[model samples]
Structures are given as structure tokens and as C-alpha cells.
Target: MDENESRISALTLGGAQERPMNEKLYMLTLSFSIEGFIRQVLTQKNWEKAYNKHDNSLRLTIKLDIKNNGRIIESIKLIRKAIFFWTRNPKIDHRIWIMIVKDDTPFYPLEEEEARQLLFDFNRDIEIKPEALKKGKNNIAVFVELSWGKHEFIEKNTLKKESNIQQIEKD
Candidate 1:
């Protein structure tokens, strides 16, 4: 080994591919060496930062316009009943449940906290039966009741302010 050369600990790569009819696939790839990965991991304190970021980047986009007093939308239909679920948080209050509706059919309600966590947490996995999916736009609705207190909605300015009381004393 040359005096200037260092040992290689790891290697990483990222790529994507796309193709059209009778056309060659388009591809892009990027590789990272151990030093760079180690630098990022040490600075961020997260070893899986790169993997997590890439995995969570893909998404399905949908937009819904809500009408006043519209409680339910009945345009989507599901052909299957079985589904799988997971959420960002590993543990949540399982007693409360939330409803997930597809057209007139409703899948079994997921735990209240599980639904909330899944909606916000991108790292988790959720799978619905393939037969339940439609070719294009599909209408689905979620009905949930989340009770919040004053503390839950604290303003950012309030969080930045220093506490007025410097110290506490017990009488």
C-alpha cells in the first residue's frame, strides 16, 4: 500500500432508472466512500441517515377538495379486506381506534395513535391489498377524533422565549 493511501471501510451507491416504449432506460448512479459516510454519520449521530432519507423520498401524491358539511366521500371501492399496518412510533395507546374508508367499504379501524403516527412518520411501512388499488385517482377518507390541549399547540415564539423564573425553591 502507498503511504498516502488509507484503508477502505465501506462503499455506498445510489441510482434510479426509467424507460419509455422502444427507448433505452435512463439511469443515474452516485457512489460514496467510507470517509464521507463516516463523516456524515459522526456529525449527524445517525448511521442510517442516508438509507432512511432515500427510502422515504418516494411518495404518491393526491389532492382532495373538501366541501362544507361533507362528512363522507363514496367514490372509491376496495376488492379485498386484508391489510397490514405499522407506524413511526413503536408503541401507542391501542384502546382508541380510527376509521379508514374506501368508497362504501371500511377497513378495520387502526389504533388512534397508530393512524396518527403513520400519517406523519415516513419511516414506517403500511400495505393495503393490491386489489384495493385503482389505476388512477381513488378517493379514500380517514375519520379520526384527536383531542388536543393548550400545551400541544404551543407557538414557536413561546418555545424560544427564556423562562422568566430563573430558579425554583421549595417552601
Candidate 2:
């Protein structure tokens, strides 16, 4: 590698602790673009860092405005349910759930600890994607980001093959 490329790479990664802080990913705003959103949820991950910055491992008491339309789409309903569960039972693993809320109410009461966990566990879904409401603008599209990590057993390819064979048998 060239001197400049190697130097920049080293500065950004190697001995990061020793280097003076110039750039901070935490400070950067998340994407509002449609494609960026889909990719981040389905593949690339940038939300996890934001989650950690906000309050890692803290339960949350969320009350965000949800889209009002009745599309019964992927994110609209799922997000609302996730928010309700997290609000009611912050102890639930957020790394596995997503909550959706409407903007009308504000009494998102919970112990401080519970509220923190509410936000932390929200990252369970490494693939948080939101689709625009079809009918009208009244349907506010809110996307709750999720977490991704390395904790899986068995090869995905093998599992997929077995599941496909099993489905055929059942059919």
C-alpha cells in the first residue's frame, strides 16, 4: 500500500486509542434516504453504533408518533407492537423485538432502568427496514433499528437446504 493510504488506514484503525479524536462516527447523522435505510437493515449496519451512543443495554419507555394509515405493512404494525411490549415489559430482549407507537399519548411511564432497557434491546433486529405508506402522507413511516452480532451455530446453507427439503415433505 502507498504511504498515505496506509497512514490513513492506520490512523483510523490501528492504535485508535492513542490518536487524537478528529472524526467520530457517533456524531454523524443516520441516513434518511430510502435505499440506505433498506440496506442498513438488511445488510450494512450503522445503527448499532448509534444505539450504543444513545444508551446501550438500557430499557426504554418509548412513545413515538406512528403512521396512521391502515396498510398492514411490514414496519407499521410490527413497530407499534414492539414499542408497546417494550414499554410494558422492558425486561423483554430488545435485540429481538421492535416497538411502534403513535404520537398521541405521552404517558410512557417506567422505572428509569426499565426505560433504558427499552431503548437498548431495540437493536435485536439487525434488519430494521421501513416502507412508505401507500394511501397517503397520514401514514408516517417510522423505522426502529435493530442489533446484529455473531452468535449462530450450524451452517446457514445446510440449514436452508434442510428446511427446504422438510417443507417439501410436509407439503
Candidate 3:
């Protein structure tokens, strides 16, 4: 076999398809925040840096950006500690919901059904809007309502900001 043929075989040996040099992988960045009843859960150090008590409800904002690809979602998981913080108070009954909005119309194939499926696969109980799915560059916003109590607070801390990027490649 020629050098070029051997190189091609090597690339495909692991079930990896050869992509164009110009083609880049997609990246999704999710920025999350926690607010509301934080004092009950956060440590003294984290509380002072990441605690915000001025908002009416416990809010978690997840800003995600997909790059070089057009996949809706991979997975979703809730932080039990954060949920516990908001639910500890017996006097407060919070109804939490998630709102997902597309900042830019996503590329084709990333439609409402895909988005719905992503959410459903993650958690069947959570509620999501069908209209939230739209075609755009690759920007999506996810708002997670942690709690809805009378108290108000806003927390901004480096530790509270959770971000993740997932790259999906088709064989």
C-alpha cells in the first residue's frame, strides 16, 4: 500500500471519519448562576462571594454556545445541593421551571423536536416551551428557576458559574 493509502487506513481504523482541514468541531459553553435562598446552603466563604439575596426567586442562568456543529443538547443534571438550599425552608413552596431560548437561529436539523427530546431525555418532569427552538448561529439560553420565595437575592461567584462544552461528531 502507498503512504497515502496507509494514512487513510490509520485514520479510519478507530471508526473516525476524515474531516476537512477547514472544518472545525462545535463547542457549547454553558454559564450558570445561583441566586435566592443561598445563606442557608453556601459556606461563609462562598456566601460572601457568590450569594445574592435581592431577587424574588432562586435563579440559575445557563448560557450555552455551540460551535462548529449543530446539535441541540447532550445532557442535563440538577445540583442537589442547590435544590436543597431552596427547599430547606418549610414555609416556602417553590415551583421551579426551565426556559430555553435560542439566541441565534440554529443550523438545520437542530429543531424543536431535537430540543424537546434533549430535555425529555434529561428529565421527563421538567417543562420546556416548543417555540424556544429556533434556527440560528449557535447560541442558546437556559433559565432554571430554583425557587420562588418572598425573599430576594442575587449571587455572583466564580465557583457558582458552571460551564461545559460538548463536541459531537458523526461517523
Per-residue C-alpha lDDT of model 3 across residues 49-145, encoded as one tens digit per residue: 3334323223333322222233444334342212112223343233221122222222211233333322222222222222333344333333222
The clash count of every prediction, one per candidate, is: 0, 25, 17
Whose TM-score is greatest here? 3
- True-structure lDDT of candidate 2: 0.23
lDDT of 2 at 78: 20
- Number of residue pairs clashing in candidate 3, backbone atoms closer than 3 angstroms, sequence gap of 3 or more or interchain: 17
TM-score of each: 0.18, 0.16, 0.22
Measured by TM-score, how close is model 3 to the native structure?
0.22
Candidate 1 structure lDDT: 0.24
- Report the lDDT of model 2 for residue 27: 15
Note the Cα lDDT for every prediction shown.
0.24, 0.23, 0.27
lDDT of candidate model 3 versus the reference: 0.27
The residue-level lDDT of candidate 1 at 62 comes to 18
